[model samples]
Structure formats: structure tokens, C-alpha cells
Target: MYSICRRIIFLETVAGVPGMVAAMTRHLHSLRRMRRDYGWIHTLLEEAENERMHLLTALHLKRPGPFFRACVILGQGIFVNFFILSYLISPRFCHRFVGYLEEEAVITYTKCLNQIDRGYLPMWAKMDAPDIARTYWQLKPDAKMRDVILAIRADEAHHRLVNHTLASINPEQKNPYKPGE
Candidate 1:
């Protein structure tokens, strides 16, 4: 349980990076070309915000100490730079990478949910869903931790599909989610 929670915390910290990097690079690209980004800017920025909420939710569950916080800072610094460079070089590859990360997040959250269901984590036995999660997802007041996990998993799945679809589309094509002509 400790290990699982630790992994979730660390992963969530890194999880928010790609979307932010993508949004930043895309925004700069759009500015340089003096054209709209279609809808990628908003979508990517929203993705970053959602991932930050996930990190916030997880932090409510587990508060790591200074050492772990330092690790998270270092890791995120490295990852942000790497992802920024990667996106600049090949946006499609960056999208594919984020898609894969979201896929892994879904799997990890599922395993966490399974552990909670199996009575392995006593702390999670009757955990209330965080208010931030409920508000972000607009869940009922009665929603529990498991419900929040499910919601997060669904978000990851959606992100995975969106990123993968983006990766496969031609760069010259307009954004897939753009307003209709």
C-alpha cells in the first residue's frame, strides 16, 4: 500500500508535465505563425490543469517529506525539459508518449482500486472522495474515493485516445476537434 501510494504520488507529479509542455510549445508555435491553433491550445492546457488536479488529489492522500519533494522537483525538471525538446522536435512523438503515459496511469489506478477493494489498504477502506475531485468531476456529495479513482481512470482513457488520435493525424491538417467549417 505504501509503495502503491508512493508510486501514484510520484507519477502524478510527472504526469502533469507533458500537457503543459505541449501547450506551451503549441502556443509559441501559433504565435510565431500568427494563426490560431484551432483547438489544440485549449485542449492541451485543459489536460495540464486536469493532471494538476490529480496531483492535488493524490497529495491530499499522501504527503511526502522534503526528500521526496526534492526528488519530485528534480524529476519534473528533467522531464519537463526532455518533453519540451521532444515536442519541439516532433509533436507527434510527444503526443504518442503522453498517450502511453496515460495508458499506464489507467492501469496503475485500476490496480490501486483493486487493492482498495480487496481490503489491503485499511486507510482507504472508508475514504471520502476529496472535495476538489468531486468539484472537478462534478460528482454527487455521496461519492467515495473509489468513485474518484474511477473518474480519474476515465479521464486517463480519454486522454490516451485523444493523444493517440492526434499523433496519427497529419501535421498540416486542421485540429480534429476544431469548429466545423
Candidate 2:
């Protein structure tokens, strides 16, 4: 009976160590990668470090009863799954709006480019047009929308550059800048 109790104790202690070590190693590796990848973003790095510290503190707390521990683990699993689901759902909605904004930008920029090419106005005159380029920096989105909008804005800027170059080449041409004209 004593031998059986000893074996059970040993197995219980030994079993958790490997799992804890594996989890700690994985978490540390992820933190290191995040730091490396986002070195320029100090705020993000700081937040990640803070979260890591919190997780470590939680891990080192005194052990709970078996039922309580099981409940805690189950709760964590549900929370994590819900968090991931919400994260995914939020981006889907954000991207849909971003697509709308991008499409609007393309149309507005195209119209401005068309007007400039047709000699209806000079390049400087159209600079303040209400296209993506003019208003992109003014708009703010939830975190997910910001990146998507910025990318779309960049593309619009590139298109503007190309169209401006084409327009400059033949200032006297009559509507030579029309799309596929």
C-alpha cells in the first residue's frame, strides 16, 4: 500500500512537470518571436510582456483543489475559444466595410484623375478632392480596419502617381487621359 501511494505521488508530480515545461517553452518562444517581429512597435511589445508576466504569475499560484482546478481549466478553454471566435468575426465585418471604403476611393480617385486628364482642372487643383488619399488619414477604425484601410490608401496613392505622370506628359491633349479612350 505504501509503495502504491509512493508511485502514485511520483507519477502525479512527474506528469505535470513535463506539461508545464512544454507550455512555458512554447509561450516563451512566441514572446521572443513577437518581440523580434515588432521591435519598432514599443507599445505592442510592452503589452505582450505584461500579458506574459500575468500568465506566469497565474501559473505559479498555490495549487487548488482538483474540482476547482478542473473548473478553472475548463473555463479557460471556453474563454479562449470564444475570444478566437470573436476576433475572427470582428475582422470579417471590418473587412466588409473596408472593401466598401476602398471601392469608394477607387471611384473617387478615378473621377478626379479623369477630370485632371481632360484639362478640366490642374493636378494641384484636384489634390484636395474627397478621395481616399485626401480622407484616409482622417478616418479611424477599430484595430482591424486600420491596417486594411492603410493598404487600400497606399494603392490609391500609387494609382494617383501613375495617372499624374500620364497627365503631365501631354497637357494640351484633349481628353487623352480618359480610361481606355
Candidate 3:
């Protein structure tokens, strides 16, 4: 469980970078071209915030030391620069990469759920959802960590589909996803 928490903490911290980078890149492009964004920025911003929320939820389970924090800082800095350059060079590739990333996130959370159900992760099996998770996911007051995992898996699935769709579309085309679809 400690290992899993550490992995998730780092993963979530890094996962939160791409969306903000893509959104900002597109925003600047829109301004430079004097064109409308067609709702992509909103969704991208929401994705970034959702990933941040996931990081916050996982943080409730573990308190990282100085080394871990430094690693996250370095990882985030590297990822942010890489993603920004990649988004500028090829938005489609960046979006597809993020789609794959979210697919792995879904898979990871699904595996975690399986472990909890099978009693392989005893601590998580008995744990309650963090308050941040409960609020972010609108889970019931009695929600457990299992419930939190379920919500996270769902969110990841949504992001996976959204990014794949975005990758397939023309950059100037209007985003197909509405606010909450």
C-alpha cells in the first residue's frame, strides 16, 4: 500500500501537467490566430483540475518526505516543458499520448479495486474515502476507499475517450465534447 500510494502520488502529480499545457498552448494559438477555441479550453482546464484533485485525494494516504517532493518537482518541471513543446509541435500526438496515459490510469485503478476486493490490499480494503475525494466525486458520506477508486476509474475512462476523440479531430474544428458529456 505504501508503494502504491507513492506511485500514485507521483503519477497524479505528473498526470496533471499535460492538460494545462495543452490548454494553454491552444489558448495562445487562438490568440495569435485570433480564432475561437470552441470549448476545448474549458474541457482541458477541467481535466487539469480533475487530475490535481486526484493528487490531492491520494495525498491523504501518505505524507511524502523531502526526497519525494523534490522528485515530483523535477518530474513536473520536465514533463511541463516536454508537453508544452510537444503540444506546439503536434497536438494530435500529445493528445493521443495523454489518451494512452489515461487508459493506463483506468487500468491501474481497476487493478487496485481488484486487489481491494480480493483482500490483497488490506489497508485500502478497510479505509474510508478521503474527504477531498468524497467531495470531488460527490460520493456518499459513508463512501469507502473502494468507492473513491471507482470514481477515479470512471474519471480516467472519460479522459481516455475524450483525448482519443480530440486526437482524431482537426485542431480548428469545434470540440465535440460538450461541458459534461
Q: Which candidate has the top score in lDDT? A: 3
| lDDT of every model, 2 decimals | 0.85, 0.36, 0.92
lDDT of 3 by residue, 1-181 (tens): 9888998899999998988998898898889999899999989989999999999999999999999999999999999988898888999999999999999999899989999999999888789999998888899999999999899889999999999999999988999988766
lDDT tens digits, residue span 1-181, model 2: 2232232223223222222332343345447666331121232232233223322322322244687556656655664455344424452332233334334545644554454466654432323322332333343333222232243345544333333433244322332323311
Of candidate 3, the 10-residue stretch with the lowest lDDT total is 172-181
Spell out the clash pairs found in candidate 2: none
TM-scores, all models, native as reference = 0.93, 0.24, 0.97
Please rank every candidate by TM-score, starting with the best.
Answer: 3, 1, 2
The full ranking of all candidates by lDDT, starting with the best, is 3, 1, 2
Instruction: State candidate 3's TM-score.
Output: 0.97
The best candidate by TM-score is 3
Error of 1 at 120 (Å): 1.4
lDDT, candidate 2, equals 0.36
Residue 176 of model 2: what lDDT?
A: 31
Model 3 CA deviation exceeding 4 Å by range: none
Q: lDDT per residue, candidate 1, 1-181, as tens digits?
A: 6687789889889988887888888898889999877788777777888888888888878789999999999999999888888888999998998899899999988888898899887677688888998998999998888888898899899889878988998765666764211
Off by over 4 Å in 1: 178-181
Better of 1 and 3 by TM-score: 3
